[model samples]
Target chain A: MRAVAALCLVIGLAVPALGWAQEDKPAEFPEKLEIGISTDEIAISSDFRGADLTIFGAIEGYDPSLLAQSKYDIVVALEGPKDNNTVRVKERIFGIWVNRRSMTFELVPESYSLSSTRDVETIAAPPVLNGVGVGIQHIRLSPVGYLGDGSNLTEFRDAFRRLKESGGFYQRDPGGVQFISASLFKATVKLPANVPNGTHVVRAHLFRDGVFIAEKALPLRVMKTGIEQMISNAAYNQSFAYGAFSVMLAVLTGWLASVVFRKD
Target chain B: MNIFIILGMGAAVGFLSGMFGVGGGFLITPLLIFYNIPPVVAVATGANQVVASSISGALSHFRRGTLDVKLGTVLLVGGLAGATVGIWIFSLLRSLGQLDLVISLLYVVLLGTVGTLMLLESIRALRRAAANQPVSLRRPGQHNWVHRLPLKMRFKKSKIYLSVIPVVGLGFGIGILTSIMGVGGGFIMVPAMIYLLRIPTNVVVGTSLFQIIFVTAYTTVVQATTNYSVDIVLAFILMVAGVIGAQYGVRVGQKLRGEQLRALLALLVLAVGARLAVDLVVTPEDIYSIVSEGVYR
Candidate 1:
């Protein structure tokens, strides 16, 4: 009985220690990967059935070279989980440029896939630059130039339309991944007025040879304003409610002060 | 304008709101209008700045133990309800497509009347003070009707006996107006507390601020969720400047006599009123439509 009790105690402690030990082991990347994007969440899974490698872990950090390097392959596939469950994927061998100040992404590459999904719209691939191979698709990525040269309203509108058409811009949609083709340009995505005020997930993925090598998800939060726009409309647009209230208060106070202190 | 310029304007309005007890709506809305921002967007954005400035002021007042929790709570409860109703009314008007013209006309009339009244009152006070006449005092029996109302209660700060029903009714009414008008409602509440409730001047400021904090905070949360109008970045920048300015204003406010402060505030109101009056008579440079595509639209 004493031996059995000692054995049970040893097993109990050993089980937890074994768990700790296993947890300390480093993770490995899988050979094949499937990435999914939904309205609320993002999921990345490795294809164990077809691959020998294992995904050890996922890390996210600022990479300035992401927009410039073309030696490795990077592809982003967006699969919707609701309703139609449509799948759209884009693959490219590109360099990356990171705007550290503005947290922007720019992709530069000698070639890029114009259409990765069967049904989704695609942009016409730009011609490859000199010295780069002429065969595949080439896209220049510059965050600053992605928008345009000027802050004029027309320029801004055109830039927005182009970015939407290019399928390489960061936009708040039902779901999608932002990819870049060249490191030559830079742009900023201004938050639209219609965006819901709440927390959102921003995922950055690194791919090579049609598979994700690394993926990272960051958290973004939106906050509230204290007054309703309708109230403002009523006050400023409809009736000087703020001014009227101020005057009423001033008059009441002035009258009361005169009466109480007998100053008038 | 550029992002930096927008941010700078927000900071400037926030500082002014902190320095003066008045809400920055008068300044911010006009400035935005002048800059060609739609009235709705201007009001919404200005409210965002007001929340920041009021928060900074409220926190300091709370720290000083000047805030009256009970009074503020009553006011907030009524105010929030009223604001909801006001928003509904505003939407109704908007759907009818007459919101802008109505609002502008109201602004003109209200400002003109208020400004003229204040100027005249201040002059009268000055003349009376110079004549060495005895100041008017409230008759002991004057507030008998207030006592007759249901839910009678005593507010120690204001040191007057009044019914809770009147207080709440006044709060709700003012709240509705405030929500409809997009004003802080501080101006209304201060007077109600002083004359109707007979609260003392010292307690009035703190109590009004307490109620404003709750009302504005609610406004911010609701506006953000429903309309996504709140910009955290903008609010943060304005609050930093506003809090610093508020501290200085409070010190300066403490040194001035109540009569002097009232007179100055009256003059400021009148000046703003006159400006609005002029805007009413003179045709707007741009009388374009105020509609825009956004979540609300």
Candidate 2:
């Protein structure tokens, strides 16, 4: 009977822990979600600290009604390991939620519907950080709204340049090509220093008017290289030590209080 | 070795919080940065830990019949409104990408001014005490501008006759600063209560903590839901330790001479202020990118 009681007590405590563990898993992806990051593996040189990230993902299935009413926004985040679990810390580097008309594209020349024209709204530039070196830089490209008929490439490039000048998108080289066909578009940008090391997510959204038409999220891994990795690992692993330090301080404070306030 | 150092740092912060009645962000933020934690994470985590400490401390004070609920409520109402406006302002600056420089400059100026004032006042108080004279503390005059304001009210604990407008205005200002800086604003609130509102010393301690509880709690929840900035696990651990430490601190506080305590606190504040001032004047190690991305974007 004693052993059984002890066993029951242990089981009760374990139940909540198990439940929490299960709940900690990443949120389940929607059934038709299509996600992909710009790169699978990023290599950093000893001199390398951070880089600009381009996240591109697409979504296919859409309900026209949902796309017409709700304001659609996509959030890309970075998650890292903490105490044996992954935790999300940063938020959307690329937010694609704007009025649908501003982002909409048109198929030019009704008979030549073989290619669609997309007005790629300006991409926002990633945040710049100071010394200590290393972190993720992000650039996002997403369609603004449902494409209509008669969209032109010149109009698309104008919009893209507008975004760049407005400081929402990264400033590309003067002769840089901004327009790409959906089938053969591939571009790689370098990452800079001050980028954080972690698992990063990139997201995209298709909006109509002000409503969301489709959304996609993708993950990219950013790891430390050479000396930086060792430093980061050492720093992160200090949490347990900090916890223990706090407890000791509590004990000391309690003892001090007892001594000082004691009635002589 | 790393574990020991981290624990030591945590204990140091807990002790300072207990002794000074501060939320410990002034200490914790620099330490987190020293440990190479990202600036955003440091601020968010510090705010989270503050919630736990304030909540636990507030409950204990409430049980002791020291908390002035009516005053706390009014302050909280104003604080909430101020926080909302402050958050909006922060978002606007962020969208403009000018938030980092602004916040950094603000921190340097605010901390230096407050710290200097505290140090000077404590020195004056100490000198008076040393001469074996009863300190002649200045009382707010009846003809003072604050009293001239409309809609005056009475606070039984603080035993002051002051206008609700001033109280609310003070709360609103403090709330906005707290929200923007991720600070509890106790360092500012306590002084405001004692000097401006003319609240008694004993009442100020409990009342300030009372107001902080609500303000920090609201900040924690808002940041969690909107920004997803609160780290519950890290906060819980610090708070649990803080609670026990605060309990003992209160006991110790009761025994210490008030003047001496003030002097010690003044010295500590001045030290922190000097360090922050240096940071502003000296070229920073890194000057770009103080704002972090969150769900708000």
Candidate 3:
């Protein structure tokens, strides 16, 4: 009887030890993502062309096992400040092209860039990606008092994406994100010179086995610097003063040129 | 944006501006648009550049003692009123997504008519000169309906005692075209002063430019306040090149006769007009256009 008791006690201790190990799995993969940009602010001056932003990040407690099944899928997306943006499709009417029907998507990004480790389709299911707003299709395009029975909604949305994409406002670079190590990753986002001046949001998402594991957001600012800033503020804020200034400057320049060049 | 291309284009525009005593906006706008600059920005910024160029020409005229300030003031009143309407039309068409179409149509018509008229008139003058036929200044000595109009005023410098109604009407008409074309209306204004208002050619350029400064200034303010489409940087760049080009143009223009100069200017205008016409008639590469609020600025 004593021998049997000893075996029972040993077995009980081993089972809990194994159970505790299983419970520690969540702790191993911390649900935290930390990201930082190479620069906090991008200044657009007179000669502003497109610029590149380096985003480096470290994932908390990344497991090698996640890669055994498939390479870790990391998607980084940049969204401009939310505003009501209109999208229209042109149809040939009477041998001339004119805008037909239109749709407005509230909270649309002026510019969107997407980068992933592999093809987005290979990383996760459509529902999972869409739910988490990972792909272009997943973007929340809340219609602003949309007309019709929402039957042709997809058509308008697709046109919006197509237009933005053509203008370099929207981009999809599958190879944009590269992993340096198991727990570290980096991405480079190229901003066109015409990128709107405003606050932009950058999101980093991690997925494993078609399941979202972690997500984080980092805010970025795109702004005009030096004279560009001054002029922009004058026009938008003190509009009357700015207008007066422009006229005064033009008149002064004209008069000055005449005075300087007048011969006899 | 290729800086070299912009500078080169600026120099060419500046030369033409200085030679013809024009603002060069008509030429600059199309090139800028071709280089992928947004149309609104192109138009507004072109206006800003015109103000500077016109002011220079006007100041020279003022120094030469050819400018008629009294007549200019009358035109200024009409121009300001017309500019307000022009800006409103610019914005209305923009929202309707038809500004590009309207701007093109206006350019084709204005340039075509003016260019053809100038060309034919210059050819006639050249033939008269070649035949050694003394060119007589044509004037109507008899009183006509134009003189019968109300609010008659004396423009001593232009040597015409005419009603302010026609002068103001002419100003108002040119003002509308100025805003739409992003020009100082020099091409139209000079001829209008000579033929329509019967102002002497000696002082017409100065008077027209004087009025243009005010007209474009008003346009600049309105566009800046309402549309916020002007790019100061772009304007500054173009201005630098324009100033230099104008200097060279003045030197070259000194060697040409009036008819020869008019014929060349007519040809240049016709070329630009024809290019715009082709774009309108030809099917575009992409029927669908994409613009956003951000690009509007």
Candidate 4:
């Protein structure tokens, strides 16, 4: 009877300890995404061509099993300044192509550069990506005005994406994101030659087994440097003065040329 | 935006303008459009370019004692008012997303009509020269409906009592063209002054140049203020190349016959207009285009 009691106690203690060890609770903090860029602002010179930007990041509290199985996916996007964009479609009218219909999408990014661990679509379902607005094809483009039947919505949206992609404004790199370590990641995005000068947002998203788990965003400013930027700034900020100066400069140039090339 | 290409375009247009004695604004705007510059930028910068190109000609006219200040002032009154109205129209069309279409259409029509008329006139002159026929000269003091108009004013330089109604009306028309088409309007203004208004031959070119300088300068300032499309770097490169080319053009022009120069210019204008028209009719590779509003300040 004493041996049986001892066996029961041992089994009870051992079972609970085994259960506790097996059912390991997730870290106190959920998986979090942290991203860092070397510089907060990029100064574009007058002769600036396209540039590649590298972002380093880390996934905190990530499960080792998921990381080893490559079940984790990372997507990093650099979104340019947002503004209302209008897409116009030209149709044949009287044997001439003319812009007959237009749709304005409210607060759309001027440029977008996306990098992902794998194809964003293969990583997650379309609905999920659309909900997160993570992929170029999934970005939300809500029309500002009234719609009659919403039939043309898809057509216009597709056109907007197609044009943006062709113009090199919207870009995607399926294999641009790679894991440097167990939880550390590196993502590279492109800055187009004609990148708009404004505050941009670098968004990092982490997915575990096709499910979004974490997101982090950092702000970056793109500034133009040199004479071109100064002129552009003057044109926008002090418009009237700039206008007057343009006229004065033209006058001076004209006067100087006339004096230099005087026939008399 | 290849600087060398832009310089070449400017120099080419400048040479032609010097040879033909006209502002290169009309040619420059179309060429910029062909080079893929936005129509808005091309138009505004073209106006700025005109301000420079017209200055030298106007200065030379002023020095030659040919400019009639009082007559030009009367014209200026109408030009300034016309430019204001034209700007309003320009902005309205821009908002409607029809500015490029309208500009292209206007260029086609204007270039077509002007080219046809100049070609025919030059051909006739050439034929007359071949037949050894004396050129028929219109009497300067001939009376017409323009002369009969009210508000006749006397100008000592032109030595004619011209009606202010026709003078101001002509300036008003040219002013609108200057703002919208980015032309100095000298090609149209010169013929109108001599044939329509019966201004003295000596004073006609000078008077038109005087009006052009002010109107184009005003257009430049207004376009810069409103559109913010005037590219100073682009304008500077064009102006420098243009002025230098004009000097050489003037020398070559002295050796060319007026009839041949006019005919050549007319052909060039017609060809450009035809190219623009073809672009309008041709099916674009992509039927869709996007314009980002208020994205760039």
**Candidate 1 lDDT over residue span B221-285, tens digit each:** 44444444444443444444444554455556667654555566667655655665455455434
CA lDDT, candidate 3, residue A33: 57
Q: What is the full ranking by lDDT, best candidate first?
A: 4, 3, 2, 1
Q: For model 1, what is the alpha-carbon lDDT of residue A8?
A: 9
Tens digit of lDDT per residue, candidate 4, span B84-192?
Answer: 7887788888877888898899999989999999999999999999999999987878788887788888999888887898888888888888888788888888888
Considering every candidate listed, which one attains the maximal DockQ? 4
Q: List candidate 4 stretches off by more than 4 Å.
A: A1-29, B295-297
lDDT of 3 by residue, A1-264 (tens): 010000001111222223322332344455445566755566677666776666777665556686655556788887777677777666766655566667777778888888787777777888888787777777887788876899888887877777778889888788888877666677766777677778988888877667777776767887766666777777777766776777777777667776787777
* Candidates by TM-score, descending order: 4, 3, 2, 1
> DockQ, in order, for the candidates?
0.02, 0.03, 0.35, 0.57
Q: After superposition, how far is residue A212 of candidate 4 from its true place, in Å?
A: 2.3
Candidate 4: clashing pairs of residues: none
Query: How accurate is chain B of model 1, given as a TM-score from 0 to 1?
Result: 0.77
TM-score of 2: 0.52
**What range of 10 consecutive residues in model 4 chain A has the weakest lDDT sum?**
A1-10
Per-model fnat list? 0.00, 0.00, 0.52, 0.83
lDDT of 2 by residue, A56-139 (tens): 333333344543443222332232211111111122123311111223222110000000112223221123111100112222
Report the C-alpha lDDT of model 1 over A1-264, residue by residue, as the tens digit.
000000001111222222321232234642222222222321212211111111111112223464244322322222111111111111121221111111122322211222121111121122311112111122222343335443443332333324433433223221122233231111112233332334543322344323334433334342323344334344433333443343333334323322442311
Compose the digit string of candidate 2's lDDT tens values, residues B1-297: 254555555556776677666767666655654566544445555655665556555655666777787777778788888887876776576455444434555666676676677667777777887897897756643345677888887787666766888778878987787666767778888888777776666666677766665665565555544444444445545555555555566567778776677667667655665655554455433222212232111
Error of 2 at A213 (Å): 34
Model 1 spans with C-alpha error above 4 angstroms: A1-264, B2-20, B60-65, B128-141, B154-161, B231-237, B250-268, B277-297
